[model samples]
Target: MGSRDLHQGATMTAMSGATIHQVAKAAGVSPSTVSNFLNGRPGRMLPETRARVEEAIRHLGYRPNRAARQLRTGRVQVVGLVVPSVANPFWGAFALHLEGAALAAGYHVLLCNSARDPERERAYIDELWADGIRGVVLCSSLPSLDHVLPLVEQGLNLVAFDRTAQAGDPSRMVNISVDNVIGAQLATRHLLELGHRRIAFVSGALRSVNRRERFRGFRDALENAGLSPDDAIVWSGAADEPYGDLDVAGLGRRAAADLMRGDDPPTAIVAINDMCALGVSAGVRDAGLRVGQDVSVVGFDDIVLADLAAPPLTTVRQPMADMAAAAFTHLRECVESDEPATGRSLLMRPELVVRGSTGPVPPPR
Candidate 1:
């Protein structure tokens, strides 16, 4: 029922399979007018004409063929964003913020969940490119962006958050992110101040740059404190472990329980994200140990779930709202203007929020 599908024969009436022409003829307007009305464009049409088109389409139950209209306009007024794991609160919350900003900027967002699967991510990228979207945002990315580099190089208006193709590759991508290094350092130092000498850094996986950066911050903090940085205490080994990243939050929930139950475990743990902290908290409870009371824990990306846990989790708050706003701003600049954002590298600092999860370390158990 749109530009390309103006003819009654090319469209369908979901319920009765009627065409646009059928609806238009019954409504007393040409197929083109009916198509425009259904496509949400009524700028020049007369008030009476617009009403007639609407009534006819309604009476005949004509539904516009979005696929057909998308061809004529060369745009769907919709932007697409591909991110890893919506089940993770960080990406999930970012999705909401992005959709909000898009709508305020007179565009709609089409969300795609890659579930951290590389193949699925590549497929979504190709699909969005084919869909004629105005702009794109990639949250989780690969180590090599050579494949998609051409698109951005050709001025495709792409903004990336979280991760990008490779280090030092800003030729085609506008990168924006929270200062994960600072946040991680804050968490690590907090544990150190609490007198926990043997602190473990936990992550679901180390494949992501965010996690890697957090580890970097953790190491930096140790070195700053004149303490030897120990990689053996880092849980990046979870990369090969099934559901490693997903278990971070779950680990936070039971930290004390598991540690107390075990004969050997760190007195304090720093989770990659708040979700991982929850899992740690769970281990605390399962072992009947008190977090902050016996074992302290900290997490990153202070999501709402972090505050909702039994003892609101102590975490490093990544300014997700500001990060999302920056993504859209950079993309809009890239799209509406010819030049790139003259200044790149927007880094929002992470704030450490202490709650029930962290506390002074208890003597060795």
Candidate 2:
């Protein structure tokens, strides 16, 4: 081969392992300029310079090393989502909407299930932080966020969902939730208007912040109606369980059966969520009672199933898609901001959707 041929061969070998430096050299630009273009922050670069970089990348088959970039910047184009459980379909729907919002903003999500375990949630946040993730949307709704406070102090932008802000939360943490107290009051008031004075509140455990607020709302509505809150039967048989996200339906079914068998059975039931309400309906059937007639049922979190259940369900509708979008937008602002800002709480109003499952209390049997 001639000398020219040997030179061309050497150039080909070098191009095979092209780096950012080589791309900058070929494009006649500085490495920092090339970096800015690659990172989607091409600020005030002349059009021709960008074209040259694009051409160089195409010619050399250059691929940016994301891991190396993350290592240097201490952040990535990905956020973490730690949820309590995926077994419940409401959570599944929320995840879908949150992922949609993240994709639109040029970011991806890493989802983890903590089953409402504080230790597990803390561990997941720690792992994400170690992996260079600087933002997270936590949906555990644990009463106290003390477990994850240390990580938040270290610059983790956290958005707490399905839970209201608490006194102990980090100053820079965002909290987003439907007003649980009002939502529950709406549910109970609907039953009260239906003349369901013998009402019962059913749930797995009152351990989480949201659950506690919901229970409080149930009591408030009863007391405001000139009825003794103490007269309401609260069945929280699974309160001692670690986390009852998966078996909530089962818990509701059992509560219904036991409550219905009592000497003074409740005329109406208020469930924690739609899944639990569906189970309660089934239990009412098992007791030879017809839902919406012999016994009334009301639920929270008007998940899709609520509309499709037999006789449908009366539920409190949470604006899930809107809430998810807001979570992403707030978390992104925190992640991209140059300086940390004081966090804010967003309390969305809930709508009570009346359906076939709730009706006036049955005539004296």
Candidate 3:
């Protein structure tokens, strides 16, 4: 084409919203080179070549067609995050942080609430696949990965954030988790140090990997302290299918009530989560006992509300934001690469946050 014809073609393309072809033509490069630049894989391009492509993109105000790119690449720049329930404060905070991190990486997050239902989790996965989303951060609370394994086999770039042990093949997907066992050990040892021999453990479902690990840690701590592990009262049951507040705090209250009614009640209680600890506090008051004074309580997952409770709860702190960022970076690498990225697992350290809800054991009557 002549100079005037080339100018006119560029103008027309600009008026119609510039695309890869127009940008490539203006830069005197192939479409693949433009694609490479757009995807942040500007490999082996001379500085002059890269500058030309960048200048063309800026001059034409070109916005790469994500849909067209998806058609060619078989995946979109969107990732789905599946959580058990956003209603839980811990998960709520987690989702917010993950969304912010994903946005910073030039990707969008599609939030899916599985409500701890197997069928719902499977349905969300199917919908995400149908919508061309190949990356997922699954925070499932279930004991089995039967519903998620098929998609992994089909080449989904999945990261199991919390309940990772349940994911069948750790070698096939990225896993990020907190050291729940250590967190639980810290809480239990804190109670033990306060001279409380009779400690109660209030937990949700033992099927959840995190909860199970916490329970094991509690037992290990008791054993290490030369106390009979069996003497540590444990109240755990099958969690509700459609998990809710009742499944958490309300169940905690019920367990606390049962523990209090016993002839030999525990002097201190360690709960599965902050929500449960809060409920146990309420249950203690209802049973004519002061929470921190009469019966000390400790919780896991120092959620935002942990500090706002009547007596701020002593709990375990997980670096949720850092974990989210690491998981997203790893999943994005898998999504954007030709081959799936090498699988890796990250275990974040958990800290103990001592607060007003726990104190020295009370004097015997």
Candidate topping lDDT: 2
Candidate 3: residue 339 Cα off by (Å):
2.9
- Residue pairs with backbone atoms closer than 3 Å in model 3 (clashes): none
> lDDT by residue for model 3 over 196-244, one digit each (tens)?
9999999766766777888999999999899997888998844442344
TM per prediction: 0.77, 0.91, 0.83
Off by over 4 Å in 1: 1-69, 164-170, 237-239, 242-247, 250-264
Off by over 4 Å in 3: 1-62, 164-170, 237-247, 341-343
Considering summed lDDT, which 10 consecutive residues are worst modelled in model 3? 1-10
lDDT tens per residue, model 1, 1-365:
23443456444443445677887788788888777776558876999888887787666556655666678766566778887667788888999999888889977888887655666766776777777765788876445555566566666667768752355575656767778788889999898898878788776567767668888899899888888876327665433553344445554444434445555677888887777777877776677777777778888888998889877899998888888988887787666565676336677778999898888878765
What are the Cα lDDT values of the candidates? 0.73, 0.89, 0.84
Highest TM-score scorer: 2
Global Cα lDDT for candidate 3:
0.84
**CA error at residue 99 for candidate 2, angstroms:** 0.4
Better of 2 and 3 by TM-score: 2
The per-candidate count of clashes, in order, stands at 34, 0, 0
* The 10-residue segment with the lowest total lDDT in model 2: 1-10
